[model samples]
Target: MNEMNETGAHCHGDAAARVAEISGLFVSIRQILAQMIDGIGVPDARTPKTIIAKLSELQSAHLKVLAAEEAFHAQQDAVGGADTIDMETIRADIRGQLDRIRAAQDAGPLSGGAE
Candidate 1:
């Protein structure tokens, strides 16, 4: 039983290390691409600058998504599994925020028209 637990823990650690490695690789790739784009200004007619810009944007967005996913997973694990919060609860929270925003919008100018 003890050996099984140890093996499980080791596998979890390995998974975490792999995630970190992948995250680092994403950052490195983004940086390298940005540097390459910078080094060659005024791309040839065949290679538009917008293409590189789009690739950079894609990488940046991917990193953000991965980071958010990792954060969500960590939070889920910290609070004991993903089922801790039901869909209804999340939807209710969103609804509450929307209600608050709508109320604020309805309130109109808060400065009392003083300028």
Candidate 2:
């Protein structure tokens, strides 16, 4: 039926939109990780504090992404179809980036050396 087809199309479109939004969040987290990595070699006294602040920011963004993904999953479930996105893989990637950021913080200078 034409109505059924239209509904199906709408669901697919919705799934695609959610995927795009999740992908953008992943990109944002990766950018934060890149910034943390770049900060590693800076010799300023406040570099550690700055990195910690950025890590906190990254965690906050990560929580938002997770919440969005959960909502997306719920929507998909309501539509009754297989998931269009591999949420587990995306979560693993995010975790890995977070781990790397934590490692960088651990390896960074501890003393408040002169900037």
Candidate 3:
């Protein structure tokens, strides 16, 4: 039996589950983008900068998904695979992403925008 890691996440022999978790994140990202496009709640609420900011977050999510997939693959213990994952690079990306998100939120919503 595999013991759960300190984060309560399954370790070893759980590649499939980890992949499924990544898939779920992708689904959420799609839903968020759709909502932003449809503007279902507020008419003309999305500002130009707001859209850009959201895209920044999208990029952040993209990097995370890429890293997750890389980690998932490496966990498989395959004979041949891509280079090992770099924890430092991933951490740096997330820090930058957080800054972008905060700046985006600072831009706030607009009273008038594309409807």
Clashes of each: 0, 0, 0
What lDDT score goes with residue 102 in model 1?
99
Better of 1 and 2 by lDDT: 2
Ordered from best to worst lDDT, the candidate numbers read 2, 1, 3
Query: Candidate 3 residues 33-91, lDDT tens each?
Result: 56654552333446476666665666576667667667756765663322355546876
- Tell me the RMSD of model 3 versus the true structure: 25.1
Clashes in candidate 3: how many? 0
lDDT of 1 by residue, 5-76 (tens): 578667767867876786677668667756765665555678777876776776676677568767856864
- Candidate 3 has what TM-score? 0.31
Name model 2 segments beyond 4 Å from true: 42-115
Model 2, position 91, has a per-residue lDDT of 67
Across residues 1-115, which tens digit of lDDT does each residue of candidate 2 receive?
5786578678878977876787787678767756664655544666578676766666676677667767866875677644555646876898999999999898988778788
TM-score of each: 0.40, 0.37, 0.31
TM-score, predicted candidate 1 vs. hidden true structure = 0.40
Winning candidate number (lDDT):
2
Output the lDDT of residue 13, model 1. 75
